[model samples]
Target: MISMFVTDLDGTLLKNNRYITKEDKEALQLLNKKGVDITIATGRSDREVQAVFKELNITGHRISQNGTFTFSKYNENVFSQVFEEGTSLKLFDFLHAFDFPCLISNFDNIHYAKEIPMAQTLQSLFKTPLIYQQDLRNRIEQDFSTSKFMLLGETSELLSLEKKIISLFDTDVSTFLSADMCLDIVPKGADKRRALEALLNQTGIKKQATASIGDGFNDINMLAYTPHSYVMSSAEPKVKLHGKKTVQHVYEAVDDLFCHNLIL
Candidate 1:
C-alpha cells in the first residue's frame, strides 16, 4: 500500500502540456480524502507547481528543477542546491555560442540573457513569465546561483548540444531533454530521485510506500527510485518500460494504486 504519490507535471499531469483534466482534479481530491500524501516532481520551477496547486486547490511537496530543490507541504524548503558561479559562467560562455534560445533559471524566475524574438511564445510555452537579464554573468556576480540552464532549439542542435555537454561537463553537470526540443542542465548529481530521497527522509515516507509517475528522461531516475511507478502512455517508447504500468491519466494510476491497496 502506498501512502505517498509523486507525479510529474507537463506531459504527465498536465494533459497535452496544458491544463489539468477534471479527472485529475477528482483524483487529487480523492487522494486527499484518503489521507495519501501527494508530491509533484518536475523539471519546472516551484512557482509553476504552486500555480498548479492554486488551480487544483491542493498542496503537497514539490521537487523542482529536475530535483535540485525540494520543498515540504508546509511550503518550507527542505533541501536545495544550485550551480556555483564559476561553473555557471563556464556553461554560460559555452551556451552563448549557440543561437538557440538560452535561459538561466532560478527558483524564482526563468531568465533570458540574449535577444530572443520569440520570448513571448516561450513565456506562454513555459507557463511562466520570462525575465530578461541582459547580462546573466552580472546576475551571477550578485551572489546569484542558477537552478538550471536551458536551451530550446531544433532536435539536431539539441542532440549535438547533449553530446557536447556529456563530453565536456560529464562530471560537472547533468543534462537531459525535458521535452521534445528543450534540453535542461542542472548541477551534477541532481535529479528527481536525489531530491525525492531528501523529501522522504524528512517526511518519513519509505520507498516501499511511495508511487511515482512520469514521462521524461529526467523522470527515469525517479520512476526507478520509487518501488511503485507508472509511465504515461504518451511518453516516448523508450521511457515507457521504466514504469511497471502505463496510464493515460492521473486518475487511472490512482485507481490502480487504490485497487492494489484494497481501498476500492
Candidate 2:
C-alpha cells in the first residue's frame, strides 16, 4: 500500500557535496514512473532543497528546515512555522549565555550574529552565502518570522546542549540533533512528525502507505511516523531502532519498497 517515499538528504541520499548517486537517481526515476510520490525531507532550506532538485533533475514535495517549512512539488509554499512572541528572545538568552555559535535561519537565508570560521566553513560546504548581522537579537525582534535556531559543535557538546535545551524549555520547545553534530531548535508544534502529518493530509496519503528513510537523530520522528521506515547502514545503532529496517543505501530502500514488496 506504500504510495509515497520520503528520504533525507545529507548522509542518506546525497553521496557527498550535495551530489546524488546514479543508483539513487535511477531509483527515484523508477518511483516517478511507477506513479508513486517522492519527496525530500531535510534540515536544509528552500535554496538548498532547490539546488538538490536541480542536481538530481527530479522534483517532488519538500519538507525543509527540519520541518519548519513545507513546499509543494512545483515550488509552492505549503506551510511555515515561526517562533512565537518572546520565544526567540528566550532562546537568544541561552545562546548568549552559553557563548555558543548560532545561526538564525529563515526559509531562504541564514543569518549569523557575527563572522565565525566554523560558519564560514559550512557556507563553503553548502555553497550558500551567510548573511552577517552583528545585532541578530535586534533583527529577531524586528522580524519574528525566524524559522529555527541552530547551534553547531562537537557531538558530545551538542548532546550536552540538547539536554540543556530540553531542561530549559521542557515541553515548551522542540529540539533534536542534526548532522550528528548540531542542535536544531524549534517551537513545540514544529517538527518532522507534524509537518509529515500535514503533508499526508494535503496529499490524502495514509501514514501506513508512506515509507520514510533517514539517518540522523532529527529524522527519527519522521521515521517512526510511518510503519515502513528504513534507516541507512551508515546510521548509528541508536537511530536504527526508529525504523522498521535498515538499508545499505537509499536506492536499496527504494528497491525494497518497489521491487521486493517488503514493508520491513
Candidate 3:
C-alpha cells in the first residue's frame, strides 16, 4: 500500500545532471493516476525545486532545504526550520574565517560570501542564481529566513572542515557530504525524514506505506525510514548500503511499483 512516492531529485531522478527521462515522467503520471501521491524531496531550496517541478509538471507536496521546509500542493509552507539569529551570526563568523567560498540560503534566495571559483562552478551546475556578498555576516542581521549553509571545495578540504564543523557545532547542526566536495550544514532537528513525518501526520500516511528512492547522504534518513526504499546503482557505496534495494534508473523503480505491485 504505497500511499506516497517520495524521491530525491538530483543524482537519483535527474539523469546526467540535467533532466528526467521521458519514461520516468510518464510512469510517474500513471502512478499518480493510480492513487499514489508523488512528492519531490531534495536538498534544493523552494525556488530550485520549483524548476524541477515545472519540468515534471508536479504540483504535489515538497520536502525542500534538505528538510528545513515542506510545502503543500497549494504552495503553502506547512513546515519549516530556521537558524536562530544568534546561531546564524555565530556560524557566519566562524565560516567566514575560511578562504573557501560559502553559500547561504534564505527561504527565497541564495547569497554567496565571495565570488570564488567553487561558488561560480556550483552556481553554474545548480543553475540557481545567487547574490554575492562581501559582508555576508552583516546581512544575517536583516531578519531574512536563513535555512541552510554549504561549502564546496576539494574533498580532503571538505572532509577536514566537516570534522571541524561537527566539533564546533556539535549536535546543533546536521552535515551531509556529497559529490565528494560539497558539505551541507543544516539544523540538526530538520531532515527529509522529519519533514516527511510532518507530512504523514497531516495526511495520515503510515511510514511503512511510503516508498522512497534517492542517492545521497542527505537522503539516508528518508530511505531508512521507509519500508520500500531504492538507491540508484550509480550512488556512492555508502549511500547504496543504506537502501533496501538498488535500481539502475527511476523508471525501474516505477516499473516495480506499478507493474509488479512492489510496495514491500
Candidate 4:
C-alpha cells in the first residue's frame, strides 16, 4: 500500500496553473480519509503554497521553491537553502542583462516586472498580488539572500537562456523550466530530488511506499526517484519519459492506484 503521495501543483494538480479541480480535490480528500500522506512539491515557495492550502482547506507537507525549502505538515521547517550573498549578487547582475521579466523570491515572492502583461500572467498563475518594486538590485547589493530567480519570456528565448545559465554557472546553480515560459534558477543542490530525500528521512517513509506525480521539467528528478511515479498526460513527451505511468488527471492516478489496490 502506498503510504505517501507527492504532486506538483502547476500542471499535475492545479488545473491550468490556477486552482484545484473538483476531481483532484475529492481524490485528495479521499486520500486524507484513507490515511495516505499527501505532499505538494513545486517550484513555488512555501508562502504561495500556504495560500493554496488555505484555498483548498487541506493540509499537506510541502516541498516548495524547487526544494529550496521543505516544511512539515505542522509547519516546521525541515530543510532550507539560500543563495550565498556573493553568489546571489553575481547571479542577479548576470541575469539582469536579459530582457525577460525577472522576479526574485526569498521566503516571500516579489514580482517586479515592467511588463504589465507578464506580471498579469504570473499573477493569474500564482494568484498573488503584484508587490511591485524597482529596487531589487539595491536589495541584493545590500546583502539580501535570495531563494530563487525566475525569468519569464518566450519558450525558445528562455531555453536559450537556460543553456547559457547552465554553461556559465553550471556548478553553483540549478535551473529548471517550470513552465513553457518560466525558467527558474535555484541554488545548486537545492532541488526536488534532494528535498524529497530529506522529506523521506524526516518521515521515515520508505521509498517504495511513496508515489509521485509531476508534469514539468522541474518534477523530472523527483519522478525519477519514485518507482511508483506518474506524469500527467498533458506533459511534454520529454518530461513524460521520467514517470512510470501517465494519467489524464490527479484523480485518475488516485483512482488507478485504488483500483489496483496499490493504496490500502
Best by TM-score: 1
Residue 13 displacement in candidate 4 (angstroms): 0.8
In model 1, the runs with Cα more than 4 Å from the true position are 262-264
Q: Which is the leading candidate under lDDT?
A: 1
Quality of model 1 by C-alpha lDDT: 0.87
Per-candidate alpha-carbon RMSD to the true structure: 1.3, 2.2, 1.9, 1.5
> What clash count goes with each model?
0, 0, 0, 0
Residue 103, candidate 3: Cα error in Å is 0.7
The TM-score of predicted model 2 comes to: 0.92
TM-score of each: 0.96, 0.92, 0.93, 0.95
Mind giving the per-residue lDDT tens digits that candidate 4 earns over 1-264?
A: 899999899988888778788888889888978998889899987877888777767888989889999988888788999888888888888887778888888776655634555566667776556566677778877756788998988999899888989888888899999987899999998899899999889989999989999999999999999989999999999989999999989898899889989987
Instruction: Give the local distance difference test score of model 4.
Output: 0.86
lDDT, candidate 3, 1-264, per-residue tens? 788899898888777666889998887777777778888898878887788777777667888889999987667777899998888888888897897778898888888876777555566667478888877777788876689998878878988988998898976888887444678888888899999999888788899888999998888888999888999998889888888889988778878776656543
lDDT of 3: 0.82
lDDT ranking, high to low: 1, 4, 3, 2
Q: Please tell me which model should have the higher lDDT, number 1 or number 4.
A: 1
Q: What lDDT does candidate 2 reach at residue 114?
A: 56
**lDDT for predicted candidate 2 compared with the true structure:** 0.81
Stretches off by above 4 angstroms in model 2 are 262-264
Q: At residue 175, what lDDT does model 3 achieve? A: 87
